[model samples]
Target: MKILFLGDVVGRAGRDAIVARLPGLRRDLAADLVVLNAENASHGFGLAPDMARAFLEAGADVLTLGNHAWDRKEIVPYIEGEPRLIRPMNYPPGTPGRGATVVDLPGGRRALVLQVMARLFMEPLDDPFRAAQAELARHTLGASGSVQAIVVDIHGEATSEKQGFAHSFDGRVSLVAGTHTHVPTADHQVLEGGTAFISDAGMCGDYDSVIGMQKGGASIRFWRKVPSERLAPAEGEATICGVLVQTDDATGLATAIAPVRVGGRLSQALPS
Candidate 1:
């Protein structure tokens, strides 16, 4: 199975770039499934239902969320109803939406998509390691009739935490890709145990800005520590940042992992 996992979509620029490029990307990559982090899709904080729908229409099979999942109060109900939309599994027990979902892919194959937030430099929540173990036990990875591929989206701030989570789930899941930092890491490789892991997948937005936000505004806020006006997406060229994973159908293990960067100042690597 071939799966494409995109990082956070920041704002209008991000959305436009994805919509403009993803269809061709899917075909070029021979992707069977596509998962995207939409937590920052709407003006860089929380996804609105409309934006979420746009992402799905633009070829995202499932949408994942992170700490900003609740930024839009109106999306709570939609999140609960939309099976393709997932929030952090480690959120408190009574949280509004689901943390994972089983989605059927082409050729009757199934993929289990799970999202969890790390505790380091993040909001306190249920232990992600425990949450992942419990969820994996319930899904029964590699079981003959179970899901063929398991993909995890770990949204958090620390690379160490993301790496730890990836190692813990090695050989148990097809891929473990990180998000939320909006800065793609150089490391991309299949783990010894067959899981594809990346510390961060980066964001789909302006490359000219500071982490996808307007540089001028972000600079002021960072330098002054005073609450500046609302941050906006940078104008100019946009890009899509993500990881592409190739997994085996029989064992649900990753065979290859590659970083995907399309458009922007970053050197481009065509999907494969």
Candidate 2:
């Protein structure tokens, strides 16, 4: 199975980039399933129902949210009706939308898509470890189970927490990628357990600013410990950042994983 997981989408630039490049990306990468983090798509805050529909229409099979999942008020109700869009599972038990979803693939195969948020340097949430365990308990992987592939998105502030979460479920899932930092890391590799792991996949917006925010305002707040105008996503050219994973058909384990960075300020990167 071939899976393409995109990072967070910032504002208009990120949305436009996804709308413009996703179809071509799906074709060029030959991705069987496409998952994207659309947490920051709405003016660099939370995602909207319209934005979710747009991403799904563009080619994203599933959309994941992070800390900013509720930044938009309307999303609270919109999420319940949209099965393809999911928020962090670690949110309180009554949180809107599901934390994990079973996506049926071609040839009668299926994949489980799950997301969890870490507590370190982040808003307190349910224990990610427990949340992941519960999902795995419900949907076992490998040939013995109905699921053929599993993708987990760890949204948090610390790399250590993200890496740890990925390792905790290393052999059980197909891939585990980090988000929320809006900065791609250099560590993209398959673990001994065959799970593909990346510290961060970066954001789907311009890299010229501070973590996708406009430079001017971000600079003022950073240099002076004071409030500036509301932070907005940079509107410059966007570079779609993410990773592609190739999994074994039988075991549903990752056989290969590589970073996908294209357009904008960063040098292009893709699996060979």
Candidate 3:
């Protein structure tokens, strides 16, 4: 299975870039499934239903949310009906949306996509590790199993926590990708157990600013140590950042993992 997982989409810039380029990327990469993180798609906080609809129409099979999942109050009802859009599974048991989804592909193949939010320096949600384990227990992987590929998104602030979580389930999943840091890390490799891991997939918005926020306002906060207006997404050309993983059909393990960066200020990187 060829799975493409994109990082968080900041605002209009990120949304526009994905809608314009994702279809071609899906075709050019021959991706079987495309999952995107869009928690920050609405002015850098929360995702709007309209934005989610645009992403689904642009070839994203599933959309993942992070801490800002409920920033937009409108999403509560929309998420109740949309299984393709998921929030962290570790949210209280009665969270509005589910934490995982199973997508049936052609040839009867199946893929499981789930997201877990880390607690370190973040929300004190339920135990993500236990939540993931419980969820994985319900599904089987492999060519003959219930699912052919399992993609886990560990949205967190600490790299150590994400790495630990990935290693814990290395052999059990196809890929364990990270989000929330908004800066692409250089380490994109296949783990010994065949699971692909990256400290972060980076943001899909412009990189010229501070993690996709306007440089001036974001910088003043650091220098003045005070509130400097609300942070907004940089409207410059966005560089779509993400990862592409190829998993073995028989074992449902990752065979290769590669970083994907296109346009904007980042250097170009593609599977080819």
Candidate 4:
């Protein structure tokens, strides 16, 4: 199976890129599943139901969110009703949306999508490692079970913590892709145990600004200690950044991993 995992989306530019290019990408790559981190799909904040629905219509199978999961109050109820949408699982026990789900693919293959937020250098949440292990235990990856693929989206800061999480489930999951930093990393490789790992997948928005935020506003806040107005997503043309993982259909272990960058300021990269 082939899985495409996109990084955090900033705003209109990101959404437009996905809506405009994802379909062609899906076709060209023959991707079985497309996963997107939609927390920042709204105007650099939480995702609204409309945006979520738009993403699904654009061919996203599973949507994952990060620290900004609840940035928009309207999503609270909408998340509960949409099984395809998932928030950090390690949230307090009663958090509305779930953190893990199993998606059935064609040819009797099932892919597991699990998302978690790290506690190191960020808001303290349940042990992400423990939560991840528990979710992995739900579906065994092998011929004995129909579950053929597993994709994990580690949404947080601290590359060490993200790397640790990926290594912990090295041989178990098909891919461990990071999000939240909005800067794509260069290390896209398959682990010895067969899992695809990338420190960060970057953001699907304009890179002309500071991490997808308007440069003018970000500069003011950084240049001076004074509190500046709220930051907004850069509206320039965006470069959709992500990773593509190809796994062994039999055991559901990644055989190859590659970075994908298209349009906007970033150099173009595509896996044939």
Highest-scoring model, lDDT: 3
The lDDT of each candidate is 0.91, 0.93, 0.95, 0.92
Q: Residue by residue across 36-111, what tens digits does model 4's lDDT show?
A: 9999989999999999998999989999999999999999999999888998889989889899888978877788
Q: Model 4 off-target regions past 4 Å?
A: none
Put down candidate 2 lDDT per residue, 71-134, tens digits, no spaces: 9999988898888898889899788889998898888888999999999999988899999998
**What TM-score against the true fold does each predicted structure earn?**
0.97, 0.98, 0.99, 0.98
> Could you report the Cα RMSD, in angstroms, for every candidate shown?
1.1, 0.9, 0.7, 0.9
Clashes of 1: 0
lDDT of 1 by residue, 1-272 (tens): 89999999999889889888999898889999899999988888889999988888988899999999999999999998999999999998898989999998878789999999999988999999999899999875553758989999999999999999999999999999999999999899999999999999999998899999999999898689778899887866788999999888778999998889999888887644
lDDT, candidate 1, residue 250?
Answer: 77
Candidate 1 off by > 4 Å: none
Q: Candidate 1 has what TM-score?
A: 0.97
Lowest lDDT 10-residue stretch of candidate 4 = 137-146
lDDT of 2: 0.93
Compared with the true structure, what per-residue lDDT tens digits does model 3 show for residues 40-106? 9999999999999999999999999999999999999999999999999999978899999999898
Best by TM-score: 3
